[model samples]
Target chain A: MNQTDAFHRRIDEALHNAQLRQNFRSALTGIMARRAEQFPDETQLQALRDQARAVRANALVRQPELLERLEAKLTENGIQVHWAEGPDEANAIIHGILERAGAKTVVKGKSMVSEETGLNHYLEHHGIEVIESDLGEYIIQLAEEPPSHIVAPAIHKNRREVAELFQRFHPEIPYTEDIDQLTQSARVVLRDRFANADAGISGVNFAVAETGTLCLVENEGNGRLSTTAPRVHVAITGIEKVVERLSDVPPLLEILTKSATGQPITTYFNMISRPRQPGELDGPEAVHLVLLDNGRSRIRVDDELLDTLRCIRCGACINHCPVYVQLGGHAYGTVYPGPIGIALEPQRIGIHKVGTLTSACTLCGACGEVCPVRIPLPKLINRLRAEAVDGLRAGTAVRGHGSMRKPAEAGVWLLWRWLYTAPSRYRLFTRLATRLRWMTPPWLGAWTRYRCAPRPAQRTLHELAREEGFRNE
Target chain B: MSDSRERILARLRANRPIEVPTPTVYAKPLGWDREHCIASFMQRMQAVRGEVHRIARDAWVDWLAGELPARGIHHLLAGNGDVGDRLASALPASIRLSRYDHPIEQWKPALFNDIDAAITHARAGLAESGSIVLWPDANEPRLMSLAPPIHIALLDSHKLHENFAAMIAAEHWANGMPTNALLISGPSKTADIEQTLAYGIHGPKQLITLLLD
Candidate 1:
């Protein structure tokens, strides 16, 4: 879909649904409030952010070495490590694993990687019965929709609707409005499936290269069950999810939990090195780690764009984002959403295709402030805009921008072309745009919906300081 | 199979390039306070619908008995400790009491929802976030701290730490890198459906932490 069309359609539908808006508002408020009380001071959070970023940076810096060590260690521990270079290869490797296992039933934990690979649709097409064991995931699975929120998959749902949805599956059950009763019902149902599942699919929260251990964090015990109850446990993780060492984890955990859910630490943290050995009562007998490159190696080589890889998918940026709050996740038209999604989906799919996704941001810097790894999401969005502009000039026609040749549009295009073609023209355009602040028409106002163009200053700060003879001072 | 811990500690702790963490300075208005910090933490939990109370150490057992019947609680699967035993003794003769000493799968259902409530003693409480950290042991199979619908935790006031950093340091001292550690703030909650605040979506619906004097 065209990015603008996708954004408009999803946002319109989501806005009409009062319940989802309330869910998102309530969840974001709860997380923000708890985080505020927990830290009360911004300094601590910033420190945590720095440390977590460093941990990931260290891991990525030693990617080749760590990947080799991780594969070797995992294989020694009776776990198969498969390297997948792209989406097709990743999906094929996973499907091959299931086919060889002859897996009829698969219980899944909340794995964003699976969403990235569209694993469930692929597996189901192969005749495997896949059940999303996570309560939120299960709700969406029943509704036949994608997750609108990362942390809370069914954030777009309401209790009354969920109660009605439950009724479809179990008619005999009473129409209980109580949340506990509904959760209990889900627990009972998923527990039975977990006990009998032929294979369990999971996503890695963090993979420790030093020990070849994969960490799964959850508030509910379902993740543990998903990884342990089935004979085979399959983890689909992106190549960038790896951390260099175990010690690098504590600081990351501290930031991840607080940033994700305002918790000091999640309820259950399972670090699995290998499947259970002979005579062990629990844990999968066979373990497989699918290392998916899927555009990450290409992303890493781009120095300006590489910061997006530092994201932990904590959803902090989304929760804090004003635009995301109003539009919701579906508007992003991709697996990831919010500020990070704005930067990532464009890169993953195509910048020209997802141009509107990047343009829809407020540039409030809230996403950057809350980011655990400090990805500078707003800056990335701006860079994506520049890329989209370049892509359009390269004659790779996108849907909306391709057709937008109005006088104003053509004028802006011609201006950028001249600016790039001549530095003096660029300086003159910048000065002219700076002086024309009052002339921004309503259509331009739409482009600046979430942000002001910062009423362009009378003079550049550097130029003003130079004129004031304050260079030395 | 290699223990990931041994390898991690070896790599990060040995031949490590240590970058000292710079001191954090917050504005005076945001300076920390012990009581206010603790109360703020409790307020966060309360905002999510979890309850908090403070009682004299000697009155906890009696308090549990009085609160249990009002909530229609009967069967109890409690952590093994001096306080848990006292609470278990207060239950009616007809209400079954199971003392946890090891990981038992059959007891999960009873702990999760079949029972009225489960009471356990927490390792410590962090005042900064109003969070209670649980250390897994033979008597606490990790699930006991979570599976139950109603979690009634006992915390001696002395066990409370001023902040998360203090709590983390304390934990490192008590247990050498916990196999599993849980830092529970309040009850289980979600805002999944239509953004409505839903309590007890997965974890405990009601988390009652009684800070014992």
Candidate 2:
């Protein structure tokens, strides 16, 4: 089996656990509900989202200049900035930094970029101790599983299971079913790591080109501890996070929270401008930013897929997605999940590797509607479907439409081309298909698993109108 | 490396000069009127599984008591110490009423596991989107607003902002503002598993906002 198949099998097996389902269900509902409660009116939130989209668009248009500005300003402000063309380069940069620091212990905040680069595993393989600071992240870390959800990493695990895991992993610590007790236990354990860690790693939510600053927002204070407590702090981020100006921040922040956790704002929005200036209370002595291109520069130039770069990793699209509900994030087989993941994974990685993620969306446009930056996700996915089909066909016309050509040759392509080319012909075929609906072919049931495929509205709308005595003019 | 650094530095200096855009030529009004905004906000709130009430200020305490038993909330962690003190006296002693004033380290875990509901005053209510802004202060631990099963926020009718821009401005202006501010609309929820609707996952199961008029 390929990487995609293996990832699917792992998550599929986990989904059977009733406890994980219950936990995921409750968590998703609360997050969706909270987000709605936070931004109750769609129109109001949409406006904020549009404004944010405009800002992101502006940043993308001037990314080369903005990135250069950010590097200089961040460097001047006492940050060592490194430019990485891809994941390997990013990992190498981080590895080099850690090696020079002689850092044996590292604590990590929740960063999707780190996941993208597979940093923790890389560091651990090299004999460096890495501990996830976020409670949800820590839970998944113990489970030896990748995060299923972005914001709430371990949304798949129940409290009882968490207690059991904690008991087994840390035998000295007592098992407590209480969520708060569990959080406290994790906190106590993680705090020790934070206090003693030689280096801290973080993912930036937004980087300001104007101020050459990095913004870290988190509900838990772990982000603060990760950035401040360690002797050295290194941020791994994609180039897409750069915004044009510091003044443009509030509008983006306004929508990010509402769209993310339905919070008007996150618990903490910490801005690190310069490394701890003299008389500063607490902050890292040295700050470094690894500006990772990682295929985003290519994505930025692709007009069809570029809007995806505007995403703040809010996971709003996932919350509203129907497909994500059934399979979960791990099923997407990539770091980014849900609707955004479907569009992003193919670009960040190779399309063939994440080809299944592209087919996961329902095309309901819920993701596009909910997106703060107005990314036309559904449209982009549709465009990708066409691209994928074209690539599969490879320009050679197949047999089928002309029976005289060759009956034994490839049929799926010829069928698709014929069906898609003529709307009237396809409508007639669908009308005939309605008649054959009662047949209930074995394979057809699997096709209709998620859909009823209602019997073509019985008679046409024209027929119903005619029966109602309206003349067809 | 030196040459690359110099090249980068020169580029940064060239772009360091800020280019301010022309003022928004057409700042369209948010596509909602006052009543419509409130109605839409409430609708979205209900959609996300939050219980919203439009109530009079004088009737607040009685209504709070009435909703709790009906909603099966027996314990509450309230941020307003004075209000919590009053609530303790008003309710039967059998029902636990804990005032939230502990340090973040202590309160975070307590709020997560112990409290049935967490109630705090909202700094601003966005009419356009049924959202409340709660800034973490000395008395209120940031986690208390999130970690619990049910979140109850009191929004003074006067605090309603027409839109989010106004909400941000008001937040910057709120005196003694803590470093962390949260704009919470509903409870913590996700549909990561089979799109099933489950309540009270990582955060609150129920989100209740009392729009005090």
Candidate 3:
């Protein structure tokens, strides 16, 4: 099946599944309420968000210069920085580093960049063992499923499912449904991996240009262990993560944590500037940073879409999104799902490939209002929708999902527009519809699939007004 | 790779958006006094399930001596720094202490499996977020606080700052940064499984702060 058809089927399945809907509804509601409670002082939060927006905007404008400066500073600090034009190059660079280190087993912290590159699959295909150390990532890795949510990868799964998964994968350990017991089992299993792994891989949250520091935030200590336990550490990030100064981090960090999980701060916030210094007790001896472009450079130039790059991946937009709440992330059928995903996936992959995803928004503006950096998510999604329509009409193959326009649908829209443009035709059509209201056809299946078809108003509002005016005369 | 780098950089440069100045709205201090800052730090730390003990500068050793045994910390890891050395010396003879003088590369399995707790000095504390900044170096390694089951951070009250941004700007952190700097708020935790909170997944489960006045 094509991408659009598959996307539709996923949505259909998700909508039909009552359990999935309930899970997302409860999870999103709690997250949204907690986020609301955290920011009691709305005025101060708005002011801070404005500042964050400007910071991201300014950094994006000087992205190239700041990137070069970051590279130079990181090089001086003894970090090997590699630039990749796309995911292929990124994987190759990381694989080469692991190969040089003779790393047989590798532990990974939760990194969306790695997911974007499909790094785990690539490495496993090459016969390298990669273990996800984060609790959520580990669960999904065990289930052999992609992450359903950005911050909480396995938010869809309840404790019972996890217990069963653990029991299946770890036959040696006795099965238990307790959350704490499950966590302990994972720790016991991953601890050995951390101790024996030859290399570690992590994603960079914010890369400070002036000091060449890669700041990573996490609640689990897995990130710290992933970077520190092994001899070789490889950090991958998008080119847009670089900030001009170390000082730029505070505001970003403040909003990122609060917006993400309503936490005042994550447990561990690490700033890695270099590899292990001489005489140092522990840390990676060789640290390599791979900066992946992967179509971000193209996004940097688009005027309407440039702000999409300013996202910090906090998942607030995901939680607050109405469509996302109803359908869940799996329905989007993209690595990055939700409001940000609808706007971004099309650009990163192509507009035509994710055509169904582009239409997966109510444009309620909830995501924009809750965004820490105040990215206009609804506006960007609208632009993608417009691009998809234009691409279809022009017979041009758009990037990502490709063109998904039907000539019949276009003709129907054109006929409706022609009738609506003239008052006489519009009135005649309304009158005819009112006369044969119950004759609505079943072929208009998309509209009436989940909802009742609306009959034309008994009389157009314009007709009622005119009749009222004549009676007054 | 160089060609890729140049091409990427050139694309970014060509497509750079209209520049705007970075806002200074968040640069102001949080207006917390010394006592208030300490209180806030303690409150914030406790909220995240971290233990905070405020003691006189001379009373830390006595407090640790009593608390360590009570908490069943048998084997404690200490760095080679003066503060670590002093604290380790002050511990009772009954308590076994190990100084982290060698690189962890030499004994990865033993260090992770054997150590009950690790002691390290925090450079500063942020009152707004209740975080202790640790700039671990050759003397005190990064894993001193991470690998063990329990992490005890010794912090001086005088070093407490209002928030992270103010601390960074005032400390001139942009000039020079250590290989690894950390801002630890509490013990390692996760709510990943159905949003159920659990502590000590891969890092320390307990974070105890010795706030010295």
Give the winner by lDDT: 2 or 3: 3
User: Each prediction's TM-score against the native?
Assistant: 0.71, 0.67, 0.96
lDDT per residue, candidate 3, B100-149, as tens digits?
88878788888889999988899999998999999998888898889889
Write candidate 1's Cα lDDT for B1-213 as tens digits.
Answer: 323323432333333223324323211233556566567667755765658887887887777677777777777777666656676657666566776654343344444446656777777876645677675554554556555667888777677776555655545532233334466767765445544544665556678988787
Off by over 4 Å in 1: A1-31, A76-78, A99-102, A178-180, A391-473, B1-189, B194-213
User: Per-candidate RMSD vs. true structure?
Assistant: 7.9, 10.9, 2.3
What lDDT would candidate 1 get against the real structure? 0.71
Candidate structures ordered by DockQ, highest first:
3, 1, 2
**Superposed model 3: Cα runs more than 4 Å off:** A391-402, A422-443, A470-473
Q: What is the iRMS for every candidate structure? A: 7.5, 8.1, 1.3
Docking class of 3: high
Model 3: how far residue A42 lies from native, Å: 0.8
The superposed Cα distance between candidate 2 and the true structure at residue B141, in angstroms, equals 20
Minimum summed lDDT over a 10-residue window in model 3 chain B is located at B19-28
Question: Model 3: share of native contacts present?
Answer: 0.89
TM-score (chain A only) of candidate 2: 0.86
CA lDDT of A40 in candidate 1? 67
Which candidate number has the best lDDT? 3
